[model samples]
Target: MTEDQSALKTLSEVVRDRRLQLGLSTRALAQRCIDPGTGKAIPRHYIQRLEDDLANLAPPRLPELSALAAGLELPLAVIQEAAGFQFHGVTTRHSESGRARMFVARFDELDPAEQDRVLAMLEAYTAVKPPKVD
Candidate 1:
């Protein structure tokens, strides 16, 4: 198969798998893909078509893909990669464990009181952050 066709198949499979892994229905997933700027959810039919591999539907635009990433709790790079874009820099992206290790390096250096403050600040941030679309 051609590269683009292979990528399209990959994207289709990934989206379906991620949605199922997250226990989301197509309608729910579509709701999560709402345009932040326009406040419009991606058409549920379109998501279904993509997942079902119906012909003639366009590849999702960057914004829609980004929304899907946020909704699916996946890194944007994963979706981008499945869409056939090769990243040139950094050889590979850092894993979640690597990110945690980096975070600990700085967090561990802080004093106890500072650590407590930071934890409290993070808690506040979490409380105020927008709720994920259900």
Candidate 2:
């Protein structure tokens, strides 16, 4: 990443890591990332540019984002949110873990009783002793 990239999980990092984790090359990823809007494969160079953190590149639209998410075998919301935070400066109450982040992101939209129930369940989970690590 460039010197200016934030420490938070970024679109660039997610794309690169997921691609590598799946043993896909840029060309393979591009072949999978077919833009639904145009039914055309996203160019390999575009995928490379995204992984390279090319400055001033616009945040991908929903179609590219959706294709990328599928190409990486990840949820669209996760990729979309990461892209927003990385490229658009979207403010979020950062969580150390992705599960916590997902919960926090949607928690505010829940009804009061629903939120209370979720918190209660969470408390119960925490109250149980975790298995001892060797």
Candidate 3:
């Protein structure tokens, strides 16, 4: 399998395993993924297909992936990276207080495609902006 496919397979395994660990049915998971703004739940069949690796839905839009992460209660960054979002440089440093410092990018520093996906997710999460008070 190609590198991307291999990564996706790993992701599929993670999703299935985590779901089982949480004692959630496929339909339950889908229900958890309901978009607050849209009130749309990801279909149970799609989740099943994803877990079975019968679905080629990798590199999904960031909004969709974030919703999945919300339903799964997994780290968004972990899911995002597993979904093939390119990350920027990572660095670890030590401070005078003996604390470790880890640096990572949240959304910026990704490739254009990944950036667009993240932007879409942000938009979805903040569908209604607060009223401006000048």
TM per candidate comes to: 0.53, 0.62, 0.54
Q: lDDT for model 2, please.
A: 0.81
Clash counts per candidate, in order, are 0, 0, 0
Model 2 scores worst on lDDT over the 10 consecutive residues at 1-10
Candidate 1 at residue 47, lDDT?
78
Using lDDT as the measure, the top candidate is 2
Candidate achieving higher TM-score, 2 or 3: 2
Q: Which residue runs does candidate 3 get wrong by more than 4 Å?
A: 1-9, 35-40, 85-134
lDDT of 1 by residue, 25-119 (tens): 99999888865545666778877887886657666776776676767777666665565432211123346678854555467457789999999
- Candidate 3, residues 73-129, lDDT tens digits: the string is 886655565555222222223356643221234443366898888789879879978
TM-score of 3: 0.54
Q: Which of the two, 1 or 3, has more lDDT?
A: 1
